[model samples]
Every structure is written in C-alpha cells, then in structure tokens.
Target: MTQELIRATIETLEMVTVSSLFSVLLGLPLGVLLVLSRPQGLRPRPALYRALDAIINVFRSLPFLVLMIMVFPLSRLITGRATGTTATIVPLAVAAIPFVARIMEQSLLEVDGGVLEAGLASGAKISQLVWTVLIPEALPALVNGVTITVINIIGNSAMAGAIGGGGLGDLAVRYGLYRREPVMLYTSVAVIIVLVQLVQWLGGYLERRLRRDGKVTASA
Candidate 1:
C-alpha cells in the first residue's frame, strides 16, 4: 500500500510537470501576441486580436471534463493511447493553454504604461522590449500567475484519472471508493493538499524575492 501510494504520487508529479512545461511554452507566446495585437498596443490589429480572443474564450468556456473527452481522439493520436499519464498530458495541456494565456495577458497588462513608453522612447524593438522590459518588470506577477495555473492543473490532473489516467486520483477511485478503503482516499487527498501547499509557499517565496531584487535594481 505504501509503495502503491508513492508510485501514484510520482505519477501525479510527472503529469503536472510535463503538462505545465508544454502549457507555458504554447500559452506564453499566444499571450504576448494577444497583448501586442490589441488596440493601442505596440502592433495593434483589431481583426487578429478579436480572432485570438474568441478562440481563447471558446476553450476557456468548456469544462475540463468535457474538454478531456472531446480531445480523447487527439490524445490517442498523439500518444497511441488515451488512458495513462503521458496520454493524459495532451488534454491537460490543451485545457491549460488558454488558462495560462489569460493569466499571462493579465499579468503583462499590469505592467506600468510609463515603463512601456520609456522602452519605446529608448528605441527598443518590440522583441527587445518584451524580452527585457515587459517580462522582467512583470516577473513577480507572472510567478503568481504560474502558481495559480499550477494549482489549477493539479486539480485537473486528478480528474484525468476518471478516464483511467492513473495517478493518486486513480488510487483513490480504485482502492478508496471502489474497494471501500477510506484510508486510501484520505491519504490521496492529504498528499494532494500537501503538494498544493508546498507549491503555494514556493511561489510566494519566489515572488517576494523577485520584488526585493527589483527594488534593489531600481535603487541602484
């Protein structure tokens, strides 16, 4: 039982890590494009902005469970199976991309307008401004956004188990619910809670450190 729980825990971590990596990779660029293509932006494009915005909204509107089922075929196509941790990552990543994108868009929007103006005045190209000024200035907020996205992903990963995507969630359903072992259920729940708490603490620490460093940089 102990070994079983540990293995399930590791599976959960792996799924979360892989899905988060892909989500950030895809979502971050979409988010940057979203901001840049908005009205009054560095490269405003009303048509493109509206199109992207609508697509994001459509994905975000779907419940995770529905999205997972809807994407099962694609998941199978990608992974050759749709009932394990690796295959589960496909739907998880799909659901998460729009979420991360919105979070990033919100965080980037929070950067001071004056800072962007200064970058422009200094003759910074759009790429340079985004890489240096925008991202750096928004680091603390972006960290917080990542923390939120991670927590959300963790929850969604558990739901993935309902379709045979194994993890602590699978353990809970199989042993705890099916076999009527309350201990197994509670243990899985406790493990998830602990993981979330740890991530939250780590995110807070990083955000604070970035803020302090930013202040020091400004003072210098």
Candidate 2:
C-alpha cells in the first residue's frame, strides 16, 4: 500500500507539472493579448477582446468533469489514449489554458499604466513595451497568479481520476472506495491535504520574497 501510494503521488505530481507548463506557456500569450486588446488598452480592439473573452468564458464555465469527458476525443487523438497519467495530461492542460489566461490577464491588468506609457513615449514597440514594462511590473502578481493556477490544477488533476485518469485519485477510487478499504481512503485524503498545504506555504513564501526583493530593488 505504501509503495502504491508513493507511485500515485508521483503520478499526481507529473500530471500537475506538465499540465502547468503547457497552460502557462500558451496562456501567458493569450493573456498578454487580452490586455493589449481590451477596450481601453494599449491597442484597443473591442471585437477581438470580446471574442477572446467569450472563448475563455466558455472553457472556464464548464465543470472539470464535464470538460474531461468533452476532451476525451482530443486526448485520444493526441496521445492515443485517455485513461493513464500521461494521456490525462491532454485534457488537464486544455482545461487549464483559459483559467491560466484569465488569471494572467488579471495580473497584467494590475500593472501600473505609467510604466507602459513611459515605455511607449520612449519609442518602445508594442512587443518591447510588453516585454520590458508590462511583464516586469507585473512579475510579482504573475507569480501569485501562477501559484493559484497550480493549486487549482492539482485539484483538477486529482478529480481527473474519475475517468481513470491515473493519480492519487485513481488510488483512492480503486483501492479505497471500491475495495472498501477505509484506511486507504483516509490515507489518500491525508496525502492530498498535505500536498495542498505544502504548495500553499511554498507559494506564499515565494510571493512574499519576490515582493520584498522588488521593493528593495526599487528603493535602491
């Protein structure tokens, strides 16, 4: 039981890590574009902003379980399977894209406009302005947003096991629930609680450190 639990925990970690990577890599650009194209943004385009907004809304509105079912075909097509730790990453990442995008958009929106305007006045191109001013100014907030996304993704990943998407969820369902093993169930729950607590603490520490360093840099 211990060995199996350890294996399940590793699978959970793998799913979370890879999905978080994909979600962040793709979502960050969509988020940046959202900020750039908002009605009163660096380059306002209501039509584009609305379209992006709708797309993100549709994804975010769907419950993760439903989204998992909806994404099964895509997962099969991409990974040639939809029931294992590796294959489950497809839907997990897909479901997280919009979530990460919206979080990142919010983070970027919180950046001070003065920095962006100063960049623009200095003849910075849109790309340069985003790279130099918006992202830098928003880095601390962005990290917090990412921390939130990761925590949510971990929960979603566990839930994915309802569909045989392997992880601690699979362990809980198969051995704990199905086999009538109350101890297994309790252990699984305990491990999940521990993982969440650890992530929360680590994320808060990093965010605080980043903010402190940012303040020091500014003061210097």
Candidate 3:
C-alpha cells in the first residue's frame, strides 16, 4: 500500500508540474499581449483587443468539468488517446491559459504609468519599456498571480482523474469512493492539503522577496 501510494504521489506530481509549465508558457504571452494591446496600452487596437478579450472570456467562463468533457475530442487528437497524464494536459493547459492571462493582465495593469513615462523619457523603445519597466514593476504581483494559477491547476488536475487521468485524486475516487477504502481517501485528502500549503508558503515567500528587492517601486 505504501509503495503504491508513493508511486501514485510521484506520478501525480509529475503531471501537475507538466500541466503547470504548459499553463505558464502559453498564458504569459497571452497576458502580455492583452495588456500591451489594450486601449491605454502602448499600441491600442480596439478590434484586436476586443477579439482577444472575447476569446479569453469564453474560456474563462466555462466550468472546468464542462470544459474537460467539451475538449475530449481535441485531447484525443493531440495526445492520440484520451486517457492518462498526457491526455489530461490538453484540457488542463486549455483551461489554465485564459485564467493565467486574465491574472497576468491585471498584474501588468497594476504597473505604474509613471515608470513607463520614465522609460520613455529615457529614450527606451516601447518593447524595451515593457520588457524592463512593466514586467519588473509587476514582478511581485505576477508571482502571486502565477502561484494562484498553479494552485488552481492542482485542483483541476484532480478533476482530470475522473476521465482516467490518474493521480492522487483518482486514487481516492477509485479506492475510497468506489471500494469504500476510508484510509486511502483520508490519505489522499491529507496529501492534497500538504501540497496546497507548501505551494502557498513558497509563493508568499517569493512575493515578499521580490517586494523587498526595491528594483521597482509600486508607483514607478
């Protein structure tokens, strides 16, 4: 039992890590694009902004369970099957990208206009201002946003288990609910709690460190 649990835990962590990486990779750029193309942004294009915003809203509004089922066909197409960690990555990444985008938009929006002006005053190009000024100024908030996104992904990964994406949650559902194994259920639940706490703590610590670095001021 112990060995099985350990294996399950390792596999589940691997899936979560992969899902989280994809989410960040896809979402961060989308978020930056959203912010950069907004009305008050460096280059404003109403049509483009609205179109992207609509896409983000469409994905963000859907419940994870519904989205999971809705994307099954796409998942199968991408992974060549619709069961296991690889298959689950499709929906998990799909669901997370818009979420991360929204969070990232908000984080970048919090960046100080004054800092941007300063960058422009210093003859920095628009791209340079964004890369050096906006992103660094928003680093702490963005870190927090990323932390939130990862935690949400962890929860969603559990839902993935229902569709045969095996993880600790799947273990709980199969052994605890189906087979009435109370010990297994409780153990999985405990593990999830610990995982959540660790991520939260690490996120908070990183945010604090960035905040103290003083490289960029909140109003800069």
RMSD of each: 2.0, 2.0, 2.7
lDDT scores in order: 0.91, 0.89, 0.86
Can you rank all candidates by lDDT, best first?
A: 1, 2, 3
How does residue 167 of candidate 2 score in lDDT?
86
How well does model 2 score by local distance difference test? Answer: 0.89
Task: Estimate candidate 3's alpha-carbon lDDT, on a 0 to 1 scale.
Answer: 0.86
Off by over 4 Å in 2: 213-220
Clash number by candidate, in order: 0, 0, 1
| Superposition TM-score, candidate 3 onto the true structure | 0.94
> Which clashing pairs does model 1 show?
none
Query: What digit string (tens of lDDT, one per residue) describes model 1 on residues 89-171?
Result: 99999999999999999999989989999999999999999998988888888889899989999999898987788898888
RMSD of 1: 2.0
Give the higher-lDDT candidate: 1 or 2.
1
> Residue 121 of model 2: what lDDT?
97
Ranking by TM-score: 1, 2, 3
lDDT of candidate model 1 versus the reference = 0.91
Better of 2 and 3 by lDDT: 2
TM-scores for every predicted model: 0.96, 0.95, 0.94
